[model samples]
Target: MIEQLGPPTLFFTLSSANTKWPDLHKLFPKTQSNTVHHNRMQFIENLVNNPHITTLYLHLRFQIFRDEVIVKQLHATDHWYRYEWQHRGSAHIHGFLWLPQAPNIDNLDSSNHESIQSVKNLFDQYITTWNPRTEVDHLNKQYIPAISNPCLSNTGVISRSEPCTDYTELVNVVQCHMKCLEYTCLKKNSTLKCRYKAHWPEQHDSSLTLDHNNNPSYKPARNDSRLNVHNPMMLAIWRANVDCQAICSKKAILQYISKYVSKTEHKSESYIDILKRIVGLINSEDTILLAYHRFMMGIVADRDISTQETCHMLLKLPLISCTRQFVNLNVGKKIFQL
Candidate 1:
């Protein structure tokens, strides 16, 4: 698609499993226990017991996003998306969108100030890292109670009548986008640096700059360096952690997307050692059926199946969705025939 349609306009990731969502909480039986630990355990138990509900909810949310946001809002000409399960059994989506009208960084001239400004304007229209709380406080000049789980709060919902409704929702949802120094983001055996290269210096105005490889990069104006890029409308509706960014370097972004979507299952060193031992045990005298059974057992033993993924498979849900269909074209065969 990149060869035919140029480069995608945006790349996004949507994560699921908001434990504090009112609808998800309602799935559990009414409990008198108000303790945080007890509620958390109960939620986990419910998820294990009812995996279908979790997967179905995720699928439904993705459908809504595809229809409303991608098609209607962004007016994407074409798109591709894939669903993957996290280590903890939750589901998330990785997607790419091709917008005909959006500026393509690959075609932009870095030296042209007008061209750079146009790209920045398009970025500011959808992506933002600024916190809405700063604007709210500037206008209200009062303190609002901090909401840990904004999805459960009534004020988190955007309303036309309430002037601060959108601001409150933006403030609460943006809080979820804050970047933390977790093990996943940190360099192996090192606590000082982030693996994803986050925590960029604060920029007062959005600008386009060339990366180390001389590829055009768009940097959104940000007040808080710890926050991730997000779309305010998406945050208000999805009410979960979301990452939205413009596709800057076509080669680099395509490489990343391909690697991420085709990533294989993570296997531990112990699992590899066990598989090798099982392979070594196969003997020439052993019956074909018995050897096959033993090998199958070894493979099954090494497999990691999460409750949500199992439920998704049993329900016969598709692992991917795309606006266009693809077919293999054998150019080598045509060349030989000619």
Candidate 2:
């Protein structure tokens, strides 16, 4: 009820008369047209099924190995404002390979189709709001600078005048891959982050094809040299259950609280000073403090907990007068929910 229909619905659904009647279609746009909104909802849906979405693959799938040996290459020099206007720099040998996978979106075909269509529909949907004869048609022609740039392609680089449908597809593929990795992390025991990309020559074209020798035709790995991004594994940490320590260690609880606090992004005179704000009030401000405490409580509470227990644990001040408030909690909306 809160996430969908949202807050505005309550305002209108309860009170009929208003001096200013706003447009409902704009706020409650047709579900078909809101790709971003749908993607967000879909992502939330995916999180419920698995916290570690395939996106976690970036941290789990690839490995990048580095060596300290430095080699100097005489490439084109550009006179930049930085580096004292020096054009020469040394490159390190970071060896790696980029492997591709046929991603499985819950092994469902419709999910894959929707993921792809979301990218296209978003672009097309935007064009619909503009005047077709002038602004829309004129903007379409301006894409040649990015699409037809000979300088980047000939040199084994893939640069676009603008990030187009193809670029969006590539991004979605990466995101889906990461989400899968996140799924693995949650079920297992590791924190992962992906930071790899297909190499220069292989990435030179949108086709992303390779030759018989398994090398990019335009920009071979030998020409570019470094290979660290080949396999996706980037960062790893121990993954355990969400840390809840109001009844356990205060330190671990502090770290968990820090993650939540960082989301607020308040400025202090300096860092590490969060102690000044959230420490002693662990009991009061039940509105905000208890809200999060209740959310964290959800981390460990089993599905069978009675409504009275849940309401007391989470909502220190319940909005509803009845004892059935706990019946409203659903499984899919929160990051750590079922």
Candidate 3:
């Protein structure tokens, strides 16, 4: 995972959840435009145009309690998928929650240290939760490397599972699916049931038009019945956000560590801290890198239909993220149509 991004990649987006105030992007823009999400539409538009990125998925997993799926968040994307192991009192944590980590392993970069934060947010919005120790302990303690071991914190008995393979597989699979879906759509007559709920030139979501002939202008991945959304790769992406995958990864590592150490001291700092140092230290004029970051982040913001089932033709990942997030919001708008 580290190699793919070149360094301990930072989820600058994730850091906002830890803030006491609302996310910086949502609150302010010009001054704190450094937020990866600022001008999300511009970023996404650029992502589609980017030549490096191909396919991508932002997976999120939710905590199921009492038969209710407590969405950590819908994460704005349905193509994201997930996997699970028998609850081992630990959970794997991946922004990309593709798989689990190993014991005696210290992957500080991919730390799933949300020690029982909140699950309710998953039901409504994308939020992070943790059953934290005191602020000092939470802020001061170093996050242990995510090697397999015993459950470190008691957020839950479930342990984070180790990642079985690189999550780039998710991108690969999604790209494949999109390709197939696109083919089928061209050859066959199928659409999001042929319609657009997208707002007007001016109209409420319900007021939008429907194309009974499946002749709608654009097809959303979640609505495309031709493409299977429940595949393994997609599940990996969604799990990163909703499930305990990140938790599971840490759990495995904690368990592994327990086997070797009795009174091991939790480090005084964690990978999260290290990322902050780097992100904070970087100059604003690092324009090329920042541009790339914005490009990828826009892709991550991409979301699909609300329906769980989909069969739409597969779409290719933008080698370079150039599609603006705003396009996704207006996917059904006839304004883009001739």
| lDDT agreement with native, every candidate | 0.69, 0.23, 0.26
Which residue segments of model 2 deviate by more than 4 Å?
Answer: 1-42, 51-56, 60-294, 297-338
**Per-residue C-alpha lDDT of model 1 across residues 1-338, encoded as one tens digit per residue:** 77777788788887774465556655455534432332555766676577788788778778987899888987888998888776535778888888767876667888898988888788788888776565646354333545454555432243433546654554545443345333236564644567656766778888778888988888888876556787776776776777888877778676876887697886633656755665666677868786566555455434476778888889999888787778988876556543
lDDT of 3 by residue, 93-187 (tens): 22332211111112222223331122111211221122122344334323232322111111222224333432222222221222222212333
lDDT of 2 by residue, 1-338 (tens): 21221111000001110111111111232324422222334433333343222222211211111111101111101101000000111101111111112122123234355643433332222111111123343334222322321211211123332324433222222212222232123233364433322222323211212346542111212212122111111100111001100011223324443663474322222222323333333556457756455444333222233232333335343222211123556776676836
- TM-score per prediction, in order, is 0.75, 0.16, 0.18
Model 3 stretches with alpha carbons more than 4 Å out: 1-130, 134-136, 141-239, 243-283, 296-338
What lDDT score goes with residue 124 in model 3? 14
Best by TM-score: 1
Model 3 RMSD in Å is 26.2
How well does model 1 score by local distance difference test?
Answer: 0.69
